[model samples]
Structures are given as C-alpha cells and as structure tokens.
Target: MDRISQLPDELLLRILSLLPTSKDVVDTMVLSKRWKFLWMFVPRLLYDDSHQDIDYGRFSRFVDRSLILYKAPALETLHFKLGKICGAGDLHVWIRAADKFSVRELIIEIDSSSRASPAILPRSLYTESSMLVTLKLNNAILLDVSSSVSFPSLKTLRLVSVTYPGNEFVNSLLSNCHALQDLVVDQCPDDNVTILTVKVASLKSLALHTSDDRVEDFAHGFMIDAPNLECFHLRDGTGGFCVIENDMPNIVDAYIDVSYALPRTILSCITSVQHLDLCLLTTEVFFLLQLRVVVLTIAYENISVSVRLLILQDAYPVSSIFPCLVRLKICTCETEWLNLLMRVLKDSHKLQALELGRHHNRGGNVYWSEPSSVPECVSGNLETLEWLDYEGREEEKQVASYFLRFGSCLKKVTIKPESTSYDRDKLVMIKELSFLPRSSPACQISFD
Candidate 1:
C-alpha cells in the first residue's frame, strides 16, 4: 500500500476519485503526510450534507478554501447539495467560479422546499463554450442563455423539480445542448405546452416522470431519430399526456406507468422490447397481453371480481400474452382470487417460478378455493413456488395440497407465513405434504 501511494500524482488522484463524497476523501488525509495533498489534486469535488456534518454556509466556505488552496484551472466533476434555504447570490457566485474551472460533470441539488429565484446561473456560465460532459440540476431555475450557450462536449443532462419560463425555454435549451446523449426530466413544469424535439442523433437513454396531481394540457411528442437508443422509461406521476413517435429496434428495457385511459396507445409504440414492469388497475389488462416479456410482475389494487375475470378470460385463451414468461410474481389477496390465477397459470407451459403474496391488509382466515376439486395440472414446467405473507391456516393447507397435486415439475416450495406462533397441526400438515411421492418430481417445502 505504501508503494501504491508513491506512484505518480495523476495515478493518486485516480485512486481518490473512487470515493463518492469529498468528505470521505478528506478523512483519508490523516492516513499519512503523502495523502494530505493528494485530495487537493483530485478532479472531482463532491459536497453533500447527508455525508458530512456541515451546514450550507460551512460547506460553501469549504469549497472556497479548497479552490484557493488547489489553484487548479479546471475540475473534472463538481457536485453540491445545497439545502432548501441557499442564498441566490452565493449560488450564482459558485456557478461563475465553476464556469472558470471548466467543470466537466456538475450536479447541483437545491432543497425541494426552496423557492427558486428567476436568476440563478450567471449569463457568462451559459455563454462560455466549455467542455461540460454532464449536468444535473434539481429545484433550480434556468435563466436565459445566449445563442452561443452550445455545450459541444455535453453527453448527459438531468433536470428535476426545476422551473422554466415556457415551452420555448425548454425547447431552446434542448436545441442548444446538441451533443447530449442522455436526457431525464422529473417533476418539471412549464407555463405552456412543451413539445420536446430531439435532433441529437447520438442520444441513447431517456427518462421522463411527470407529476400525477398537476395535469398539463400539452400534446407532447418526441421526434427521436437516434438509431442507437437502447433504454427508455416513461412515467406519468401527474397523469399528464404524452405521445412518442420512434421505432427503436435496439431498445432492451422499458417501463411504462400511466392512467388506465392512456395505457394502450403509449405501449403500442414499443413492439420489440424484452423486459417490462406493469402497475395498473384491472382495466389495463388488454395492453398487458401484447408485450412479449420474459419476466412479468403485475400489481393490482382494490380490484373487483368483474375486472379480475376480464384479465383471466384474456390471459387463459391466448398463451401468447406471457408465452415467454419464465418468472411470475402476483401481488393479491389469499382469497377466491387464487382460482382465477390457477386458471391463468395452467396455460403458462413455459413458466418456471411462481411467487404468490397477500396484501398487507386482509390478513386472517384468508380462503383460496381451487379451480376444481380435481386439481388442474398447472405450469408442468414450474420448479419453484413461493407463498409470501402466509398466515398458516386451513386456507394455506388447501393451497399446499393443490400445489402438491398439480405442480408435477415442482422441486422447491417456500412458505413465508406471518411472523406469529406456529400451530403444531399446521407444521405437521406441511411436514406430511413435503414427503408426498409422485412420478412427476420430488418437491422440497420449507417455511419461514
């Protein structure tokens, strides 16, 4: 380790760069005299209150002292987490100094409760042609930038809880940041409808999350022409509306959450996706049937029997809904709903693993009626079964019996019953069922 520290200054700085926060790097200064000055040469300076015991004012002073001591012309990265009550003028000065240093990666997070001032970034910081590779701002304001505010070296940009003047403000910012490859916007609101047009052909990743409470009347659309785009995440927290127009052949992962009224049209765009996570009320089951997913996780809340039947009716008829699904996790109550699920699982010939759980509420004497007195053979390829929140009752025994008879290919069974006193009778029942023999497969059952 001593020999490692004796390496060149560039190598030493590289080693220090692995620390997530500046305080962690500072604590290492006490290790030895040789390490005292090493942190000063490190290109990344990250200041987060959550990682240190200093307030905003003290942190600002630390940054000033560090800059004066290092006297470096540029920084590779600069991260600051100023609480909700930061001084506007102090923030402006910090950005101005960062601009002079040509900071490559900048992350500035203001407290969520702080009201943003209209003027935050100095005009010089935006106008200067710097080599900023990544920029992330939260709960801040974007001032007017000159047409010369072109970031030729920028690759990633993220804005969350930020305020913009109008749609034109956002459009101009995106148009100027021409070299951006990744874009993320969360809880950002504009005065008018925003139409985000992406001309950056190198863009590969995009994440958009809107507020569910504030509905914006914007007919939003993306004109993405990037052939190399791979990952996309779109969530409507505010229940806003958006339209996507792109044929991404390289996209491998996608997540879509929207109101029941707007689920189908948005998902119809991504026909070649492989992995998907869906959370919807029962009405959106039609859209769930279209995806060719290998892993499917579905969450339903306060769903009624009529809606549940609709899902079973569609899922059982066409195995193509989850034809490639090998792992399935269903979050529902241990009530009659299991009958509907059993019907669905009987059709999933390719399923290998199953996870069943009851909701946190509705916990006692939960009953699950089998689809038939003679258990229907289910997922003959299933090898593992997990029952979550199992409150060992007669209902649980019935469930175990159904699995014992129908799960011919099962090899492992896990019963995670509620953490309570175990009944001796239920324990004996589980033990006897574990030893049952069949020509299909030997199943192992355990409880926690």
Candidate 2:
C-alpha cells in the first residue's frame, strides 16, 4: 500500500474511483499523506445512509465535508441516498457543490415512508444545474419550479413518487430539456398534478404511472405529444383521460396496464409499435386483432360469469384471431381456466407452444371436465407444453392426461411445481405423467 502512494495524482484518483461507495474512497486517506486528498478528486461519489445505526449529524457532516473538498474536474456521477432526517438546506448545499463541480449525473432519494414530510428541493437545483445530463429524484417535493427551468444537457429524468405543486410543472420543466430522451414519472396517490402535459419532441422512452388511491374522482389525465418516442409504458390506474396530441411513428415497444382509462385512446397512439403488452381490468379493450404471440393475465374471479364470457368474446376474437396465432401464454389466477383454454385451443389451428403460469392463492380452483371433441391444434399442431407451479391436483392431472392422450405432435411437456412441493410429491407426479398414454411415439415428459 505504501508503494501505491508513489503513483501520480491522476493514477491515484483513478484507482480510488473504483471503490463502490464514497466511504471506501475516503477510508483510503488514512493509508498515507499522499492519499489524504486523493478521494476528493474521484469522479464518482455514492453516499447512502439507509443503515439504522448511522448518526444523522455524522452522516450529514461526512457528506458535506466530502462535497466541500471535492476537487473532481467534472463529477461523472453523484448519488445521495439519505432519509427524511436530511434537511433541504443540507441537500441544497450538496447540490450547489455538485453544480460547482459540473456534475453529469445526479441521483437523490429520500425515504417516503419516514414520519417527516418529503424533502423540498432548493430553487438552485432547477435553475443552476445546466451541466447535469441525468437527474433522478424520489420522494422529493418540487415547489417554485420556474417555467424557464433549463436542463439543456439533461437526457434522462426520473421523478418517482415525487410531489409537484401543480400539474403545470411537467410541461414547464420538460419544455427546456432539449436533449432529454428518456423520462419516467411515477406519481404518488396524492400528487396534486391533475393533468400532466408531456409534450417533449426529443423523448425516445417514457414510463408514466399514476395511482388511483385518491378518494375524489376528478377529471385527471395526461396530454402527450412525443412523436419521436420509441418505447412507452403507461400504467394509469386512476381511470383518467389520456390524450395523445400526435402519432408515435417511431414506437417499437409498449406495455399498457390500465383500468377504465380509455383503451381506445391508448390504442390509437401505439398503432405502429412492433411489440405490446396490454393489461386492462375490463373487457372494453379489443386491440388483440393481429396477435400472433399473446400473453393473457387472467384474474376473473370477481367478474360475473356473463362478463367473463364477454371478456373472452371481445378480448380474444377467436374465429379469425387465432387462425394465425402460434404461441400463447396464460398467467392466470386459476379462475375458470378450462373454459378459456378450450376456447383458444378449439380455434387456434396453427398454435404450437402453450405456457400456463399458475399464481397461488388467487381467484378460484379450476375443475376440468373432458371436452367432447379434440381441437386440431392439440392433436396435430401442438409441439410444446409448459406448466409453471403445477400442483398435481386431480383436475390438473386429468387435463395433463388429456393432452398426452391426444397430442400426436407433442415433443416435450415441462412441469414446474410450486416450491413448497415435497420431493416425494414431485417423484409421484413424474411417475404418473410417465405412465400416461402418449399419442406421439417420441413425446418426452419432464418434471423439475
């Protein structure tokens, strides 16, 4: 370690930069006099005080001291993971120092579960941090944000569960970030933002989530105009209006998990996406017209039997929809599984792969009764069958046996039981599946 001190300042700072946390870098100063100020020039600083044993005053002092003496030419990354005990003044000073050092990336997370209020940010953060390229703030309060707030160099901004004084904050702050390409905003249940306006033209990726826990059912929503966006994920449980001002021509992938949040509006904007993962609470959505590979999340326990039938009819248009369908995945809550399975299998003429995921303690038990006629896909086209968390129930066994008895083209059947299943139970299931009649001579069974 003594010989390491002989290294030049640049070489020493570079070596210190490899440390995971700022504390590790600071601890190196005790090695020798040559190492005393080396950590101050390290490009990266990660300070986290989640450990319960940490003294608040001591933690603040260490962070303040580190920033005050930080002589890095340009801070590449500065992460502060302090809790509610940290005041705005302390954070303001640290952020100003980061600005002074020309930080490229800044991340600050204050615990939201703490008894104290959210950390209110200082005005300097929005106005002075012109050099910051990436900024992420969680559980912080954004107040007095200027309409002229400029983050010209900033490319990514994530405000998760953060509070904004008004709905205007989104449009006002994002308008100035000319270089921003990635944006994420996960609103808290009580965030005062009523109508978030995301009108950035340069944005390439956006993930926006709004909660529905608020008691009032106001006309809340979003106004989007990002035409160049390539990736989008929207989970709006608030059942609000979402207006897309322009078409997203460059969209490649999207995941939509919404509830009564106007499925038509959601579909119109994501017309050009190459891939989509959709989740809606009701059966009003019917965009799976051209689905080749479909993943259905089934939780139809609470829904009335008539509504469930309507969901199958409207959501998955069987006659023409499954003609071209090949692969299907159903992550279900064990709610009337046989009805949904038989409906799809009956029409999916070219279906080849089937994957069933059974989530425990959800919905209701599925009682399987043999179908009158074997589907064409099951007897001829089906090649692979996968069951995740297979409980080896009698109903499950009957369904498994039915597939084995009829699937002439079955290549492999894989079964993964729940973690709590005993080794003896697994062996029993394997033996039972092995003894079952197989229509295909080369069919293989696996349980592991």
Candidate 3:
C-alpha cells in the first residue's frame, strides 16, 4: 500500500537529510510506523523559529526534546535560528550538546535586539570543538580568548554583527584556527575592537565590514597578512584598512567599499584580481591588472579596470580606455549624465548593452551638451539600450535622439516611463522617440 515508505531506513534517512528543516522530517512520523523514530537516527538537525505562529516557549521545548532524545552518535550538522525570546541559558546547553555530538557544522543566529547586550558564548565552543568544520555566529558576543585554544578542523567562520572583547582576542582566535579558509567579521557599533588584525596563512576568502559613526568610535586600523587569499570583501566607513601591507598574488576577486583615501599598498594586494567591485574611490589606486567583472565608483582620475558587466554608481566617468569591457550599466539619477555616458562609450569599443537607471529629481550642476563626435561603440558594436523610469525631459530627449541617430548596429530600445507621468505627455514622448531617425533601420523601440 505504501511503496515509498517501504524503502530501507538508510535510504529514507538520506532523503530526510535533504529536507529543509528537521521539523519537517520529524513531522514525517505521521506517514507510517516505519518513520516513527527515523528522525532520531538522522545525523543532521536544523531548527528555525521564523515559521508562522511559533513562539519561543514552543520552539525551545521542541529543540530541547529533539537534542535530548537524539540517538545519532555523531551529528554532522546542528543549526539553530532563534528569536529574541530565547534566553542565553538555553543556548549554553545547546552548544554543549553540539560539542558532545562532535558536530562538524554549527550555525547559531540569535535576535540580538532582545537583550541589552549580546550573550557571551560558552568558552568550550572555542576550546573543545576539534571536529567543527564550519561555524557561523550572528549577533553574538566573543570574550577574550587566550592563545591556548585551537580549532583544528575549522575552515569557514563568520562572525556577523558580533561584539568582540578587543583586538588581541581577534588575533588570538584566528591564530588558533590553523585550517581556516574563509573568514568574515562584520563588527557592531561599540564593539571594543579598535584595530582588526587578520594573519591567517591558509585563508582563501576574507570579508571585513566595520562602521565608525562618531569621532569617539574607534575602528581605526587593520593589519592583514594573508598571502594565499583568493577573494576578499572590505567595507570600512572610516578608512580602517587603507594602509594594509603585503600582496596577494592568489587573489582572483575583490570587493572594496571605503570612504577615506587609501595608499598604494592597498592596490598592490589585489593586482591579480580577475573580478572587482569597488565603490566610493578617493585615491588613485590604479585598477587591477587582471580585473574581469567590476563595480565602479565616483570621481576616478583614470579608468583602468576593464571587465564585463560594468556598473557606474552616481559618478563622473573619466576619459579612460576600457578595452575588455562588454556591457555598461549606469545608475546615476542625475539628468546631466550625457557626458558621463559618452566618455565611457567612446572608450569601450566592444560595449554591446547599456542600461540607464531611474532618474532622480535632484539634477547635477553640469548641463547637457552634444558630443563632438559619435563614439566608436555607438556606430559599431552597440546592440541594446534600456531606459528605466524614463522622465522624457528635454535633456532626456536629446540623449535618446543622439543614440538613435548614431548607433548604426543598434537592435532595440526599451523605455519604461515613470507611472506618474501624464498619459498625454507619455504619448508625446513615445512619439518623439519613435520618430527620431536611426542609423539602423532594423532597430525596434519597445515602450512600457
């Protein structure tokens, strides 16, 4: 009568392991007598309280029952996503249970807003968990760890919005993890860390985000010495990692978002990056030598990082050759974007697609003027242009007219006007754009 349920327990447990949550696997007991206790034998368990109408009392009881009665000798994964109602005492017991099970992967996410301060994790999590492979703690607290601790199997560790005791605690914790490969530290305000130091030798990926809003907040410096890093993401509001030392010849991709200017040492680190996403540039850090897919920024003196899928975010484009670029997306809301667009278009000979982002009300100081000559990409390689939330102002019409008239190889024009624009005005704008003479007779205009 039940063909699927009649399969062997091992095969059923394998399917149960692939489930989204352990709750669903536990609920499968209603299927038949064969699955009545199958959940207890499964080596993986995940519990999240975000589901509908599940309060903390019910969530805590279910977790306690599940962990206490678990028959699995060696758990590979034990995850918990709790809300603010969960007390820190329960977490201590759960972390101890994970240690006893020798879990390989442990992820704990607590709603940090529940308490005045983040709950400090049990020290055994740092010292005793030799079987852990991946550990992620969100909205947690880390006390000062001595040099005696070690995580021999830890490879990926993420501490998001986590409060740290001090800089020494960070260095001590990282140094103990000899096998760490991926590390992320997104600090919270009032976090005691002033100087974040990362000196992992086996690390391949590192992402650091620190914010300092006031003058008193001290997230001032960074000392990184990872020679084998392949990718890193750094977002520092107060220029914390500007003067970082050493080079990463193994770096293949890098994402940097900083406010203050950085020195030459920062550029030397990511010279071999094949993909880069850089925002808010204040210094002339010269583009990467092996850049491939890039996120551009504002006010660059010279453009050098040539990559596919280029994004320009509210900045003037400097005159620079982009030989490797194929697609350009500009999201500057200002109406005075013709110069910015043309400058980039002139140099990107291989460019094919262009997307103009939503126009904003606050216009820039610069006025629109026709380019002296049509750009090479416009007449040769350009294929498609999309204007989102097209306002169809006088300057906007000039941009549309210039591109339609000169783009010889253009294939399509997609215009999505703002919903607030008057129907009559939209019709007139569409008519004007449709009537504009195009160098490519096969080009099609799409209006939405």
Candidate 4:
C-alpha cells in the first residue's frame, strides 16, 4: 500500500479525482501518512456547505493554507456552494486563489436569501480568457462586464436568479461566449432589464423560464439567429411567444407554452420540427397545417356551454391540424365533451394510438358522471385504446361497450381505474369481449 501511494503524482491525482468533494478525499488521510498528501494533488476542488458546519474564519484560513501547501498549478475545477454562513468576501478570496491555479470549470451558488450586490469578478479571472470552459452562477449578480469581456473557450453557461445591468449585458455575454453551445436562464431578475436579444451562431440548445410579468415584454418579441439549434424550450410566457425568424432546416424538437391568444402565424415559422408539445386555448381561425407527431394539451376552467360551442366553431378542425398524426392524447376535466371531440377524430385514418384521461383536481372533490357511448366512427383506425381514471360504474360500462362494438381494429384495450372496486357487470362485459379473436375483430380488454 505504501508503494502504491508512492506512485507518480499524476496517478495519485487521478485516484483522488474519483472522490466527489475535497473533504471526502481529505478523509483518506486516516489511511496512511502518504495518503495525507495525495489529496493535495487532486485537480478538482469541491466545497459543499451542507456537508459540514463550516466556520468562516477557519475555512478562510484552511483555504489559504491549502493553496500554499499545494503550490503546484494543477486545479481544474472549483465548485463551491455557499450557504447562509459564508459571505461574498470569503467567496471572492477562494475564486481568486482558483484563478491562480487556472481552473477550467467554475460553479458558484449562493444561498437563496443572500441578496448581496453583484461583485465584479477579479480582472485576471474574468479577462484572462484561459482554459475556463464552463461557468454556472445561481442566485448571484454579474456587474460591469464590458461588451468586450469575451470567453472564447466557454461552451455552456447557466444563470438562475441572476441580475444583470440590462439587455445589453445579456447580449454582450452571449457575444463574448462565441463557442457557447447551450444557454439556460431561469427566474432571472428583470428590474433594471431593458432589452434581451440572442445572436449566437453555434448555440444548439436554449431554455428560457421568465417571470409572468416579464413574459410578454422580455420573451415575446425576440430573434434567434442560431441556424444549428436543435432543441428549444420556452416556458411560462404569455402573448403567443414566437421564434425569432431563422432558417433552421435541421431543427427537430421544440416545446412552447404561452398564452391562449398567440396567433397561428407563430407556428408558420417552424415547418421542419418533428416533435412538438404545446398547450393552447382553441382558436376560431383555423390555419391549415399538418404535424407528423404532436402532443397537444388544452386547458380551461369553468367552461360554459356557449364557450364550448365557440370552441367547436373556430378551433382547428382535428382532421386538418393533425392530418398525419399517428398518436393522440386527450386530457380534460370534461369527459362529457369527449363524445363530440372523438367524432372529429373518427375520420383520421392514420391515428394508431389513443389516450384519454381526466385531469386530477387537487383541492376539490372529483365528481364522476356516466360518460355517453362512443360514436360509431370513433374506433376503426385505432389499434390501441387507453382510458384513464375509470371508475368501474355502469356508465363506464356503457362507454366501454361502445368501444367493443366499433373498435374492431383495436389490438389492446386498457382501463385504468382510480380504485379497485370493479363493477361485476363491467367485468363480465369485458370478459365476453376479450374472448373474441383478432380474425373476428373483437376488442381484447384488460382492467387495472
């Protein structure tokens, strides 16, 4: 063991890197005298406040001592999460020491309650433009970074609850990080915010989660110039968020959640996307379009009969919106409205899978009413049918009976009940249908 510990410093450093944090590596000092010094050579430094009752005074001294003891320039990563006990000055000192060692990745997280004003990063650390490849800052502030503060080697940046000077601050950050491929910003403060723009060419993935108040002003009207972007996610925004006009012929996946009033013209900008998830209020004006694979969720509260009629009038006809859709999922609180909606899908010959579920109400009681039978046109093209929240009631039996009669092509039918009390009549009805063979085109049913 002693001989093993005496191996070259590089080999010992690689062994210490396997430990998650510096303290964990330090604990190995009890193994032998040689192991005490082995951890000092590890290239990665991790400080997690939750793991220890850190004394700021002692911690400051320990960090300074550690830096002096391990004089070699070897650190590659410095990850620190400051809890309520640490102050900004303590963090500043450690960051400066890590910069001297040429750390490549810097991850700093401040306590959620720590509202200290943003500190200006040290001149050498921010402006040196060394091997720093990734930077992540959470619940902190970034102040006074000039438009020329470029990080040519940085590839990924994530900011959460961070306050910047203005939109130009964000624009300048993106411009400097030319090699950035992934950018994520969530819950960033917009008090002094003026403008936000994205003009990165190499960016491939972007996620924006903004405050409800700033959703329209900050997120709605923006342009993205990344042609190679493949994955894009926008959340909690209103006023029909639209993509900045770009020719991303290679774009394949996207998720957009915005207000009900967004115009259909926003979707026209994305013609090549293959996977899409959206939640919207039904509109009266139907702009004819087709999707190969789509998961659409519609939500409303206290819908009235008149509103329902309006939805039937202007909502994009199911046939035209998903003409080539192979899978369909419908989630709603109004099960009574399913009969009318299924009638529109009956003509969609390409639909192979169908899922229907009722939304679970949190605080209020869930009232289950008898659902009417499926229309004759509801089942021929579907091979699979899943009914969620089934309550094994006589009304549920009537709904199942309609599927048995019309869903001749169904290979499997699953009924997921919220409870285990199976209605004897429903079980008998299902058993009778399950005995029928596919050649005879009888529905095979299962209950869970």
lDDT of 2 by residue, 254-337 (tens): 776554324455555665655445444322222331121122213324223432232223433334334444776554453555
Where does the lowest 10-residue lDDT sum fall in candidate 4? 288-297
* Residue 186 Cα positional deviation in candidate 1, in Å, after optimal superposition: 1.9
Error of 4 at 76 (Å): 4.0
* Clashes by residue pair, model 4: 167-195, 284-314
Model 1: CA > 4 A from native: 1-15, 18-36, 49-58, 71-74, 84-89, 96-102, 113-119, 123-126, 146-149, 175-179, 188-201, 212-228, 284-448
* Cα-based lDDT at residue 117, candidate 3: 61
Task: State candidate 3's TM-score.
Answer: 0.70
Alpha carbon deviation, residue 422, candidate 2 (Å): 5.7
Local accuracy of candidate 4 as per-residue lDDT tens digits, 93-157: 77777667877788887666543444334434466545678888877666665436787888888
lDDT of 4: 0.58
Cα deviation at 11, candidate 4, in Å, is 7.9
Better of 1 and 3 by TM-score: 3
TM-score of each: 0.65, 0.73, 0.70, 0.66
Best by lDDT: 2
Q: Which of the numbered candidates is closest to the native, going by highest TM-score?
A: 2
Question: Backbone collision count in every prediction?
Answer: 4, 0, 0, 2
In model 2, pairs of residues that clash are: none
Worst 10 residues of 2 by lDDT: 289-298
